[model samples]
Target: MKFYRLTFLASVFLTAVMLLLVYVFDSAKHSFSETNKQFFQTLIISALILSVINYLVVDFLFNFYGKRQIQKISTILPEEIRDEESNLNFKQLSQKFTDLNLKNTTEIDMMKEMEFYRKEYIGNISHEMKTPLFTIQGYVDTLLEGGVENLAIRDKYLERIDKSVERLLNIVKDLDMINQFESGEIILNKSRFDLNEMIREMIDVLDLEAQKKNTKIVLQTTSNLMFVNADQQKISQVLLNLISNAIYYSNRESATVTIKTKVENHKVLVEVEDNGMGIKAEMLPRIFERFYRIESSRNRSDGGSGLGLAIVKHILEAHGESIAVESVYLEGAKFSFSVAKAI
Candidate 1:
């Protein structure tokens, strides 16, 4: 409507000016009676035709260019494309394209990361299994070659075979648990319980193992019976994993592992810290990953399944909580997690 209106006004204005010019210039050459009326009529008809032509051309060009741009953008982002009736302008479409481009870039980066992790995960699993499998095979081969006939080394070889089998079983069980957690198959049975008491119970269960290394399990907290709302059994497993890690990794002849708890911000903050050989800064981020171990401690013959921290992570995530670790290279390592306070 505006285009047509502007065209009409322009055509009328030009026609009026032309008519005035004709009168002024041709009045000297000829009389302005019959000739002037004919000229005026011709000019009026020409102006009306030109106005209609201008409106049609302008409207066609505008619609054609607008629809073409919309089509091009829609090919890339079909879901984000607006309907024909929408009042989307060129600037709005450009902004939408920018946003879509950013989202696509981010998704691509994430896919690349997941691919890297997938390959690494497969490699780690293969390496972990092959080490024990080959050892067990070698022991069996030796036994078959008459080592079993000699009662002296026979028992030693058998014990080593049993330990290898146990390690393999632990890895498989831990992997299964991780899969169940990831698939949401393990449902947590939540209950209100005394968290301090539970920690003490864990310490008691691990007393013998700690005694072997002369590691002291100390409980340091503001209260003796801090209550928490969580899955009691699952939380106990978490405590066992963390405290045992501290004990196993302690490098000193006599190490002190402290279990501390305090009520903070409607939650109980629990920390299991050990004065052990702390982890390096670079290894901290990957510590919770399955089968990931620091190179320095990788050869240490410990009873860990290498999935303790991973299990702890999954269990805490199932409880809708997070766990964190802090450590210096040679000072000590601390693992902390929060639980809901029983109100």
Candidate 2:
């Protein structure tokens, strides 16, 4: 419509200019014949009009396509994205598009990571469960195949089956405990207790393992009793897990595992250090992840539910504390945590 209006006005102006020129330059002797004058003016006007119409058509097509492309872009957006009167500029639209693209990319990456972890988790669970299940099945089969008729064989098979069953029970219990901790179902029974004394008790409980490994367990501290304000039982569990890990992973023939405590500000920092095949720097960050074994083959032989470190971490976090690990590849590893000091 705009192009048509402009062309009509341009034609009128050109026609007026022609008439004015003819009137201004007319001569009496060579005055143009009316028919001849009309014919010549018609020829000039036809050429001029055709050129103008061609330029107008090109200009109109350019604008038409530009508007059509913009309209196509607008339709890709949802209706609720903008109000009818909100005239968004190209720059603003481009920024919004970039933001949406980034968000989509992040979500996609997260989903892929989750899928990978899911497969790893399932594989680990199956392997962990299957070992004990198979052992128990084998022992039962042995007893059924006339081994039960012999008193000696029957007793041995029964013992082996009992041990396998116990391992299964431990795994199940650890799983249940971790589930409860994650779901916020277990409430802490916080109280004031002697941290050092608790460590002593835990050492006594783990004495056989330490002796078996020929590792000497020692406690080093400024005082024998460093009291802390938290759940004693949970803290004991943390100590047991860390100390036991230290003992189990120790590579030295006569490894010395140390439990040390210090008072810093209003917190008691406890560290379990061992001169063992220390964890590699790369594995430190993931040491507390559930079922993440530093030495899968050796750890399996050592025997555990593989949820010990994870449980310890959750227990510390529940008490508003945090745990950290420091280690060199071959020197040794130290696991530490801080708890509020009893006033």
Candidate 3:
């Protein structure tokens, strides 16, 4: 509407100026002859014709260039956002483009983060495998270089080789288990089991190891038999990992690792807490990340695959649950998770 209005006004002004020039020329001539009258009429008709032509040309150019620009912009937009039957709305198009750019930026950032983690994971895996591989190679080379003929040396080298092989196998096994859990390949065989009994069994299993660290494994609960419906084997692994970590990381001379369970709603809340070298506040968030360690030197010395907590997290998540942690830097850390009570 504005374009047409402006074009009409310009054409009218041009016509008025032309009429004024004709009037001035006639006045200067000061004649009212037939020839002068014909000239005046012809000049008036010419002005009107030129004005109409000018208006048409301006309108044609405006529509042509404006539609072309809209079409070019439409091509860059997603099909769903484009309007084919009508001219494009500039405001809507600008907002959509802004949103699309923001979405792309977020996705790019996430990809970069994932790539970083991938590289770090690969490096950690290489370092972990290389250490044991080198140890095994050294032992085997020594045995082949005449050490096999000695009775005691041969036995010792073979034993060390076996241990290295076991460690490698453990790494492979843990990796495979994690992959299975992540890919949804491991199906839970849920069953009714006594939570208290399982805690006792795990404590007994790790009793010897706890004794080495002078740590005591204690179970505290109000109920004797708190039954839960869960994957018994996986739950056992979770308990084992948490309990073992508690004993291993304890800073005290005689550490106390406690396993507690209580009834909450219709669920069983189980907690494994210890008076150990509690993890730093900053380290707690990444504690369940695969191959993440609080103290790398000490963690490696403990001969862990470093996938324990990660596996524990995966198992619990698969059972439609989540685990929580609490800790103070030097006091202790507690890991707790809930399971549905068997009906």
What alpha-carbon RMSD in Å does predicted model 3 have with respect to the real structure? 9.1
Q: Which residue runs does candidate 1 get wrong by more than 4 Å?
A: 1-60, 65-104, 295-297, 300-303
Summarize candidate 3's per-residue lDDT along 117-211 as a digit string, tens digits. Answer: 98998988887788789889998999889999999999999988888888888889999999999899999999999999999999889999999
**True lDDT of residue 282, candidate 2:** 81
Off by over 4 Å in 3: 1-68, 72-87, 299-301
Q: Measured by TM-score, how close is model 3 to the native structure?
A: 0.78
Please give the lDDT score at residue 172 for candidate 1: 94
Q: How does each model score on lDDT?
A: 0.84, 0.81, 0.85
Q: Alpha carbon lDDT of residue 210, candidate 3?
A: 93
The superposed Cα distance between candidate 3 and the true structure at residue 30, in angstroms, equals: 33
Best TM-score goes to which candidate? 3
Give the per-residue lDDT of model 1 (tens digit) for 1-343. 3365644665676677667656755664454455687667766876676667667666755665675666666645557555443445566777777887899899999999999989998987887888788889999999999999999779999999898888899889999999999999999999999999998889999999999888999999998789999999989999999998898777797799999999899999999999988999999999998887755446523556678889999999998999999999888899999999998
Each candidate: RMSD to true structure? 7.8, 9.3, 9.1
